[model samples]
Target: MSFTTAPSRWSDVWLVTAARGISSCGDFLAASALTLTLQSAGAGGLAVSGLLLAATLPLVALAPLTGRLADRVDSRTLLVLAGLAQAGICVALANTGGPTLMIVLVGLLAVGLAVTQPVLAALIPAMVRPADLARASALQQSAGTLGALAGPALAGVLVGSFGTRLPLLVDAASYLALVAAGLLIRTRRGGGRRPGPVATGAGIEARAWRLRRDPLLLATVIGVAGVVGAVGAINVVEVFFIRETLHSSTTTYGLVTAAWTLGMLAGAWIFARAVARLRRDGALAGAALALLGGCCLMVLVSAAVPSALLLVPIWVVGGLCNGGDNVFGNVLMARRVPEPVRGRAFAVYVGAVQGASMVGYLAGGLLLELLSPRPLVAGAGLAGLAAVAVLAVPLRRAARAERDVRPVSRDEPASAGEDAEPGAGLATPVPGR
Candidate 1:
């Protein structure tokens, strides 16, 4: 599809995008304000870590159920509820002064976010035609990246001038705006279809096995998880790298982070155009992984480079690669998975990424005790490269297999039969038929 091709449902796409972008900005603002609040209250490192844990740990735990709900329920309704819940949490946060209360509010907010994410992912493929999926994915990502880039700075300004509570109030208002946007979206898929039976533990396991049967989709999930795990180490050691290794000030660190965000925004913009011309499959996903690995390697080089000025552009490139990988990964999942099971697949994907990142954070902390930031950064780069090397052949084979398969029409039942492995027979119809 040409990048310029406007689908009839473009308004729906933009509405969803706007909702996510605004909500994300509010989320970041709330997070920053929460952190600042804790810091000013003289909270210990453990207390701060507890806050972070509250924000992320539920994502891993509730992802499966949330994903299932996304598939069975009206996504617009789920989004609306999630937005309202988050807005309430933010309002509560604004009023609460105690650290314990703040922690509870943040956890509730995180739950809302966790529920919203997979539903949003599942909703996108249904929002636009297959041809425009890549562009739509890119546009969605661009909105998120732009929001993330702006949110922190806005939070910093608000907290510095007014106070942390004001930002929380603003964040609550943003969630109301998100709810408004959610209401505006109209899905072609009926809003009130009876959801399939909720998956039990055994059923969840079965769903996972089905996901694995699709080689290309599995490969995409693993590749993304690996890269995320590897690159995540930088989050742990970046402060030390900036201050001790490079002898840069706190302002420089902020600037470097902004540079990466800017790069992500640019990358998302560039890839929206690029994806229109490229084939959508595992090979494209693999290429994106390779680019991401190369970017991580650049981070290693940045550590060794003497000039802080040079690091900005390097981080920017890293951000570009990160953004590209995200776009390609989303497009691949949308194309490969059937609508019936998309929520489960996305749940697993999100879990894998988050779980892997958690592992990386723990490992990075351990490694920092024994090694300098430069070596740790270099190791992260190498880890990314290694993951790409291991997955390259499988990804290529999956790509070829996909290329040989005839495309499935929108009206066709995505699953060939009740017992058929989803996506296993891309070129063939059900055996009985």
Candidate 2:
């Protein structure tokens, strides 16, 4: 709350950032290794999709429970225990041989991720003041992007030399970083209330934050989910696209995919500098939409690249957009939502994204049987672009609504007709649910 706490907050940010980067590297290492193993075995797109589904379903299904748990339980406890469990699960996965068993283990790994995701997300806002939220989000995002950038390339090399099990082991080791971070992080969100825990008890009862309630957040979240859904199948199609369509080697696939993540790293910092200028939540939301659209445009353009080498530049462009989008979304959530309900908001957002990705995964598997990789990639791009176009109008309306209304302080009552969305209330408080 005070400038005195600034040093501590930045420290907390660094600790979280380091741990996140390492853990992300492990996750991607394991994933790329597994995908490589499956593809090299000629297991086909359905097999890959099934693998993806296993990893994703628990996040969507568990969002409600995990979100509440994030709010109700100690973050340190969750991170320490979840990280340890994930490490053990990865070890088991490495030793196991069967695809069915592998899928099951991956799902278990994701269970840890689901818990940690919201826990960390909610805690970041708690660590820093309002002015620093954008920078903190950028740091947090950059860590994840950097970790992701490292993971696949590591997997590519490790898998080629020592086989899949070694990369899996490395991933297992990465979980310990989360455990260390949990122990080291000074900031924690839990059953105990922090400063300004809830705006008003009556307001909490009448109008809890829900993703569907705010027009801007609702529209922003839905738009993001839509785009992810549109592009999700690209994950499934890409292995084949790189390996078969472009005749690239396995290592090439891993390295090239990482280029997007590298771009994401740069984009996070790049956008963070600009975020201060976009003070309004509406402006932030609009920026996110624009970035998402740019990402899709890059995807559409990638359809024509004749070689895998060419994908690096295209994906870099997309990755930059992706990273910027992430920063804006995080800033939007931290800016607009009250502190107490942030856990639920982030969980719901993550769930929406994973769920949309689930749909895309299934579609990709089915479509692979009917169409080749190039056309499928093109279609995915077009679908994502269309989602952006359709969502633009709602975003504009939300922006206009924001511009029209004078903002209210926490002690004041919200305007009666400020928002008409059902079950909606002000970020502070309002008369109606």
Candidate 3:
């Protein structure tokens, strides 16, 4: 478990980054296409919610298994296999009919995502030394943001002209990038890989790493999950809020969404430079929470806007925070979690967020049946802010807990033992578990 990584693999990292972006675009493309297809076919709100559930459920439910799988299996094997499986499923999904069948296919697609997400997340840390983590995290995040920005727009155009089948097929094709990247990228981990410690006597310390055992990490994860749960309902409410209350055109809404993605892309780079200087785990945790609060504050303010056009500027600010917060969380994890179990940690972290988002999505759907969109939007923001406020106590306690521990220089050891302080964790690669 004590093996050091090869010097930062920027070229290999870019291969993974490009592949991730391409696959991510496909994911969004298929999602957008499917949603449009369902709506055009006169599917009810329940059906749409169910579709969303299908797409998300596997990611949350399979974390324990997938996390371990990511740790035990080879990255190249996982990426290539999962990518091929997803592509085949998407191809089938494109030609298939019926809500039930399509829903099942979507769930299967999520199965691939559950496997690959942690693999890529954990791999990025191993791609570079701790000094380059912020840049890598930002680049990876920016890729995802750009994918999000592009996917829906591409889906809109393709689905409008050629129907969902073409767009979905395009999605299937995107998986080829992953397969190529898997074959091309030189740096690899898992399957008893180089950087992670073997489970020998001394390396037991590496495998012993756990999120709950680290209070700062646990608090940060919990706080972020809570905020996500509190605000996730906004995703459901926003369309109705913007169209009905703000009286905006569909084009305006699209632009507003794009603005947020653009903001996040900008924020990822902006915060990458800013947060690298924040060398303490405690500080990174605080900054992430603060940025999340800012994201929600924008959501809350959007509820009061008179026109959807105005939301563009507001969302840009919000998206920036969201993107920046995302980087902080990734960097924080890469720093604290031992390299051996980093994949499992990331899987758990993603499952937590996905689970929280499921609850929020359900709440948004259920609430929309009984409440106005504006109130729900405002309430989502308030709930997120409140969650952050409540989390302050635990975060403060975590900071104090670190006070008694000795500080490790940035160049020192990366042991993840409970006795090791935030500075030591900061010197390490990452801890998402």
Candidate 4:
């Protein structure tokens, strides 16, 4: 997994990363343009919220089917087809003029995105060795962060110069790049197996039941959902906070976002080194929670200070913590979930997080009408800290249990079901089954 080992070992990882970066850039570009277009059309807050919801709600609703497909199909082909579908959706969006039609098109694009996420997540562990998982995750996240950082700024320029249509076209072109990268990826299908029987609703339920039986996995998913929900609230109110509380212009808000993105990049780079040092599961989990708590505290502090200049540093710190948490969380999932069940596990995890975020978004909008942004942001910070405190003991115990269990090597058969004994690590075989 080290750079000195072999270049071929990490080639698929880089290709996946590249594809993700390109895809993310397109997403942000389209998102920014869509927001601007909606605003220009005199769309109200509720309409804007609906548009955002349309873009995210599909992920929550379609998780079960998408996860099953990720497990039963070739991820490479899935990703490529998804990208093509999105490209077509964007083209349809470009042709549409009505707000309702545009919303439907965006929802269709989100469906394509929803399918790609779990497939790509499940494909990652197969792209590299076990020891390289953390580094690879960090690298992939950094790529996506960089794309997010650039996308909006580029969109702003493009929109100002040529209106929203050009940016939409650019986004369509970006998907083609994603398809090309996906085609280049050489990973095995379903982590090295032929397509299994199509997963029925009963089979999906059984897989979900298996996940619930695993204490550590269940805890991780819930904890992540809580944190994401808190963050989502902050996002919903951030623009209002900047404009009303800090008396800042849109440009200042963009600058603050850029600073956060820079911090995320730095944090991802740091994680590439830190993961190797923090080999213990408990320690990594503890470190990640600490960082997340610190991020929440920074938000609280920024709200209290209420200065545009001060917000930049606060957001940078928050972004750093977020980047680290993302890396650790993904690595943890990759380690804990069996390859055969990873698609379902990721599906549950992603669905929970997105559902929580949707709740936060709705709640934030309702709360904003009645309350100030500062208090809401502070509340989010407190909620994140509370989650960390509540989960501390269980997470530590899970870490200790995992520390004693050796991982099943990548060369071993990964087709075995989730038969691992309690506390025997994630990939062990059940005695009789």
Candidate 5:
């Protein structure tokens, strides 16, 4: 489908999202396989969780620097490098039998994954017309969720028979394939990286660094942080909840995670449709309200101890909100931030998200260990609602500003044109799917 708000050449954008999905499937399969591998090797619950956390911590830690790097260099090259690194790490992980080696490999994998996200995010505007940002974001979000749903199931089968090494090998191949695909897709847009400060003599870099002070961006970070916190909390607690409350096994826990992915897929589809019709800002506000309601419902359900059918409803709500939120958030970021600093802005955004998630994971793990899963889950839901409530005013103001700017940007010429308006800068390129 074409959009007046999108570029004339949107087909390329779809290709990127599709490639992303393929890559995600491989990554997830590797992750699932790795988790199982550690479990089968007599890793304790804390150890398995610790391995997962270690892999993610690098992403959080390196996000700011990675973002800065993306702004200074070609995002596609970075993307290719990150993918290759992931492939290499998977290979290392596959060959290793020692838990220490496994942990180290996992940490490397996290660094690769962490660095790729911002670059990928910065690339969206380059692949599509500015007007189509919301649609593209929605599609990407859906692809990711769907990939998550399929990856684990595939990995489970592979690990059940061939053992974990095969899945890691497959993941490595997927990354190599992504690199090939990235190399084939060419664009005139410069990499999202900004020039270095002072010594580097890149005036552009200095200006971008200043954008870190933007109140709108700060608000976005705070809002996203809240959502990330809730997501992490659920991620940490859900398995334990299913195990303890529902008396489920590992397979069932995996299925529950898949259910969440299914919800996210459905949500992304719905959110994309909504954005195509209502525009991103309005659609986002509406979706946020719906999500907040769902969270409230979750709290009630937690108290009541609902049936299996009830669980489906909760999954649907969570998935829909999560998917919608992602699309909306990306649209906002793309629209609001200056293109020159997109890499750093996205990096900051990513770091904030990871930071929130880190806190959430640690807190959730501790809380779950000390208290009941019901309280943790319900508390997160309530906290999500409270977050939405707090951000309502600022979100409204930002949305108004975005709508005001959209028309002016639409009337301007493409950045490649000499006649391009003064404020009409080129979009940043990204490496992530």
Candidate 6:
């Protein structure tokens, strides 16, 4: 039993990072460019927001199928195909004259995104050393944040100066580059052994059924759902909190958002360095508390004080917690779920989080419409606090259980195949199923 050299491991990191960056760039551009394209095509307020809802729907509805596909086939190949599909949709969207056609194209693009994201996540464990999982997750988050910050601004400028259609073209081209980067990657397949008869097809169904019986997974979905909900609420109304609550203008709101983004970037870098000192659950618990505290501070400030001077610190702290929460959640998912079921497990995880987010945004908007910005902001904080309190007991139990569990050594060879062949095949094996 031997290990790969450090140089080989580093190459894998580069491959995964390249793939994520390219994909994030293309995704951001497609979504951003499409918004302007639709507006130009005579979309109204409700119609415009509906396009976003259309995009998010596939992520929730198609997750189980996409998750299964990620585990059952070549993840990199799937990622490449997803990118190509999205590129085609971007072209279709750019040329479309009707609102219906544009909406259809964006929906297809979203479907591609739903499939691509889980496959990209599943690929990380295959590419990096097990001990480096948290660091890898952090790097991925940082890359995504940087891509997101650059991508929309780039797309906006292109859309305004060149034309809305041109940004779509740029997005399509980035997907082409993403495909090329994926081709350059040469990581081991499936991350473990090929699935046995029981672990293959009906096996997938069984796993889904079995997940319903597991209290730990269920509790995790709930706790993480609340965190995601809090994020969604912030996304919808944080700008309003700055403008209305803090009495700042649009430019000031933009600066506050930028500060938040910077905070997230810094937090990711910090987590990559500090991950080794904390157990997986400890990391998640700490992140949850941080998020809870940040929201509490923001709400208190927005409701009681409402000062523009506090906006920078509030958004920065919240954004830092947001980034930490993402890294922690990804690591916990990778560590707790078995390798074979990881895709579906993550899919469920993704769906739960996203679904909760949608609800939170709606709740925030409704609350704001009915009451005031102060109450809405304070409510988010209260929700975060309640989530922490309710989930604390279960979280502790799960953490203890997970700590007692040990991972299979990389040196141990499975009987299904000689070794995991580099670059894709059947599903990986579950460590302790």
lDDT for every model? 0.64, 0.76, 0.73, 0.65, 0.59, 0.57
What is the TM-score of each predicted model, taking all chains together? Answer: 0.77, 0.89, 0.88, 0.80, 0.76, 0.74
lDDT by residue (1-433, candidate 6, tens digit) is 0112243365666667766666666666666566555544544434444565566678778888988877787766876787788788888777876777776777788888778777776666656554454445555666666665556556556766676778777778877765775677776444344443223211233344445555555666667666556534544455456556677644454455555555666655555334334444444545544554454455445545557656677666655655555544554444345566666767777766666666665655555556656666666667666666766667677656654663434453221122211111111100000
Winning candidate number (TM-score): 2
Better of 1 and 2 by lDDT: 2
Better of 3 and 4 by TM-score: 3
Deviation in Å, model 2, residue 410 alpha carbon: 19
Off by over 4 Å in 6: 1-9, 30-49, 96-103, 131-138, 155-163, 188-214, 238-256, 272-274, 280-283, 286-312, 364-378, 396-433
Using lDDT as the measure, which candidate wins?
A: 2
- Candidate 5's C-alpha lDDT? 0.59
What's model 6's lDDT at 362? 60
Better of 1 and 4 by lDDT: 4
Poorest stretch of ten by lDDT in candidate 1: 424-433
Clashes (N, CA, C under 3 Å) per candidate: 0, 0, 11, 0, 11, 0
Which sections of candidate 2 miss by over 4 Å?
Answer: 1-10, 131-135, 194-207, 407-433
The candidates, ranked best first by TM-score, are 2, 3, 4, 1, 5, 6
Clash count in backbone of candidate 6: 0
Error of 6 at 65 (Å): 0.9
Q: Give one digit per residue, the lDDT tens place, for model 1 in 178-210.
A: 688778887633246533433321123233446
lDDT tens digits by residue: candidate 5, 1-433:
1112334355655666776778778877876677666656655445555665676688678877887776667766877888888888888887988877887888888787766666666666656654455456556665666777778767767877798788888888877756765676664233442323321111223354454344445555666566556545655555556556666544554555566567666765565444434333433444544554454455435534544335655665666665555544554444445655666666776666666777666766667657877677777666666766776667567656755654333333222221111111111110000
- Rank by lDDT (best first): 2, 3, 4, 1, 5, 6
Where does candidate 5 have its weakest 10-residue lDDT segment?
A: 424-433
lDDT of 3 by residue, 1-433 (tens): 2323468888987998799789878987888678667756866456666777787799889999999888889999999999999999999999998999999999999999999988887787667765555456556666767887788667767877788899889999999899999988887888867453444211235657777777888888888888888888877666567656777644455456667777777776677666546666787789888998998898888888887778888888988887778767766775566677877888888888878877777887788778888899899889888988998789978866775573536853332221211111111000000
lDDT of 2 by residue, 1-433 (tens): 1112454388888999899889988988999999999988888889888999999898899999898888789999999999999999999999997888999999999999889988887787677654455456556666777788989888888988888999999999999999999999988887675445443211332136566557778888877888788878888888889889999887898888898887777776676566656656777788888888888788778889999999998888888777677767765665556666667777888888888889988898999988999999899888888988988888889778856874534443121112101111001000000
